[model samples]
Target: MSKKCSFLYGTLAVVLGIATSGSMVGSVYATDYSGSETIDLSADITDGIIIKSGANITLNLNGHTISTTESEDTIYVENGATLTISGDGEITNIAGKANIFNNGTVTINGGKITHAGSYYAILNHGEMIIEDATVTSTSEGNSMVVNGYYNYTSTDERIGYVEGKGIANPTMTINGGTFTGDIKNCIYKGDDGSINNISGGTFSGAAACVLQNVNEMTISGGDFTNNNSGYPVINNQYYDDEIDKGVVTIEGGNFTSADENSPLFENGDNSTIEISGGSYSLEPDEEFIVDGIGFNQQDNNRWEIDAPEEPETLPTVTEEQNPATADDILTTAGILATLMLGLLAIIGALGFNKRRA
Candidate 1:
């Protein structure tokens, strides 16, 4: 064999062996897996992974691990791209943000996601929704954090601590799954919206579910537990300036707070708390006053929420016009005229009979 050809073949074999073994890693660029293909991260993916803009990427961990030891973000869902996870896989990042920005969604149907650093496990700015997923934060101090901003800012000084934050319009809808963390005022829904927790999953946090100056909070189902005492489970006090503007509706769920002051507080009269159904075990006080009905409980700890029947609407009545005494006199005059005509006719007939005799 020629010396040059033999040397080229030897180099190719060594490169192939490294790729086959799990020791060496691969640097997959954004364009490499942009199509409808699934990029399996079986090997160690060194450096930060950025699902660049304009790529509809499905990151199938394939039961692999994506570990990073850096202060920067490990996996970045850039503009217009998506990062979806399924099956028993894991995404681990310490000391950096798991940032999912503009128009991106981080959907985890099944897998274990650990965000251990001070950063958030899921930072959703655009639209983030979860179903049958497990999102956990092991960070001791604060497990999760999410912030949003208005599209524009007035002045640099006027810009508060959370100015120019995430998307102006961000949505967080948790339909099903389990989220375990000790969040502070961590989850921040924007001005026009709020966090909606429907049926399914478990949400446990030390701090209150802060609903600031925004719209209503409709929680139909789920399990919310606060082991702490005296602090309300949901605090609309953060929306002090716009207290009456904020509203909360809790139709169904199993809600509990270990502390006496842990009731869901409605700061203003307009800010209502309606309990249509679901079992709740809360030590109530003056601070935690719900405007609507409270969930009743039996002897056992199990709560019972009755299915509310629809309200019946009342029938409408029409009003009549006023009556006049003059109309009654007119009716009496007609009766008198008929009686006089009969008397005259009888006298005329008796006079005709006398003339004939």
Candidate 2:
């Protein structure tokens, strides 16, 4: 063989070897890591990992399990960066801290994410998404506490047990997967203003799904169960700005608020709560006013609950049957008399009715 041909064949063999060597192994890559890093996993990892900042990283796991023993956060993302986890992987943490915290964007396309966090299981500052994954949270068994400190003073609020200091009004959207947690406040959009939208998923939060001030909470389509103890599913209150009233809207979803109050509560008139679709049933004592829109559900599993643009009208049907009037009675008597006279004329012709009255 020629020397050039031999060299090409050797290069091809090297490439193929890397691809097939660790095909069934779990791995981690820190493509955007600029700071120092350390990784201690519960399972064996096949390939070495890198840490960089401002770069895209893909952490692939080959059916391996990674658990966090201590209270420290498992996955931490700083600066402006992106972290994507792929493959049949599982991340489990047994504390109140989240397995992943992204100051930028964190996407979990496929994996099993489990947490027993004392606080929030996963906190995102910028944007966070879970697609085609199973996220489960066990009982942290912590008491519900809601106290924020100001000038070394603490006041008790029924704040979310999971989320302590509310999030910075970040835009949080979930499209797919199962998320279960025993959280006081699953997502808190601090006083900075936030937008929360859930299109598709099976989300079950032990406490309120959202606790924020001056934020917009919108649920379109999903299997959501907010079985909290004290507050409603979406509760927003006590803000510095009068413009911080909360807006809770349920456009479409399979949602159930088991408590006596509503699954959603808008305290002042400034706070607006609208429900448009999915199965809705409040407690007997609680009433849902129709000041907003009606429930409209589609077969395709997509729904939206929003304020109507125009007013609605009642349906008109045909009138029902009633008793006969006075005019009908007079007309019937006259007809009977006419028939008698015709019969009498025929009898007179035959010499039968000769007496005249």
Candidate 3:
């Protein structure tokens, strides 16, 4: 081969090697976090972050992004582990499952978590706390769901008994954050012992802002909005016979709805709502009443409702005694004139009798 030809071939080989190395450098695999560790991502990650058992991990996005293209959670926290996310980063999951499947505790202090075409932004079976963050679900699913599982054991006649255990209930607490979604329910609590507490944040949904099933919910300070029609801003539905009642207490917050027919509170089966202090405003056609129920005005800033009751009616006036007719006025004046004439006659008769004596 000529020298020029050899130089050209060497140049092509060098370009190919560089391209291959660059591709290798850009590709990132799934990371398994064990023990106590902190990982700060400097580039976009393509795989998920897994926290193994007995691990306490903190994954800081560091202004980067973690994305997953598969139908899986972007971050999976296993049992007996904890994951804390900090920094103003992003976690994008273009999957069908939840973006965060938390079996253990998961705390998000600052970040943006988005789930597109997913069931939920966060399916928490353990505990989740969002202090300052934004979580969104961009599909027909909920933005956040706190659910539970059941455990059972099956025994075979020929073999030993097999035991299976799973999550039972979950809890979520939001101190300051934003949860928005265009779905059936933005925030849902599906199992017993599932509790949701919102001290400060903004929650909006397309159909229903929140739906709790036989659970307890407390909201101190927040803003809740529902955009759809014929649905309440907060709906507490009964689960089953075993757990027939759900309780919701609103100490302080702001509740509004875009639908005219939607009330501020909806109580299903055996649910109760106690509003201690909140600014609840609805559309012109909307009201602060419950559907097919009654509420008690506990105080100036509080309202409690437990069961259905008849509304109180105002006392009826007797039409102000027919507004004093003309006949009545004339009769009263005649009686007064008669009394004056009798008094004058009695005085004249007494003077004449004294003169005669």
Name the regions of candidate 1 deviating beyond 4 angstroms: 1-28, 31-34, 99-103, 140-167, 182-197, 205-216, 237-245, 266-274, 283-294, 307-357
Predicted candidate 3 versus true structure: per-residue lDDT over 106-185, tens digit per residue? 89899998877747677666778889888777666443654532211224311111222124446788898887776666
TM-scores of all models?
0.62, 0.56, 0.64
Please give, for residues 1-357, the per-residue lDDT of candidate 1 as tens digits: 344223322332342333433321322233443544355554544344555544565566667666555565656665456666566677677765663333365565666666776666665555566676666675544325342322224332112223233344455666777766655543333333334445666766556453332445567788767665665555542343331235656667777765555554435444545555666675333233355644455576655644477999887544345344677789889999999999999999999999999
Best by lDDT: 3
Model 3 pairs in collision: none
Candidate 1 global lDDT: 0.53
Q: Show model 3 residue runs off by greater than 4 Å.
A: 1-34, 141-144, 147-167, 188-192, 211-213, 241-244, 282-357
lDDT on C-alpha atoms for all candidate structures: 0.53, 0.51, 0.63
Runs in model 2 deviating more than 4 A are 1-52, 139-169, 182-192, 205-214, 227-231, 238-245, 259-269, 283-292, 295-357
> Looking at candidate 3, what is the lDDT of residue 309?
67
Count of clashes, each model: 2, 24, 0
In the order shown, the candidates' Cα RMSDs to the true structure are 12.1, 14.5, 16.2
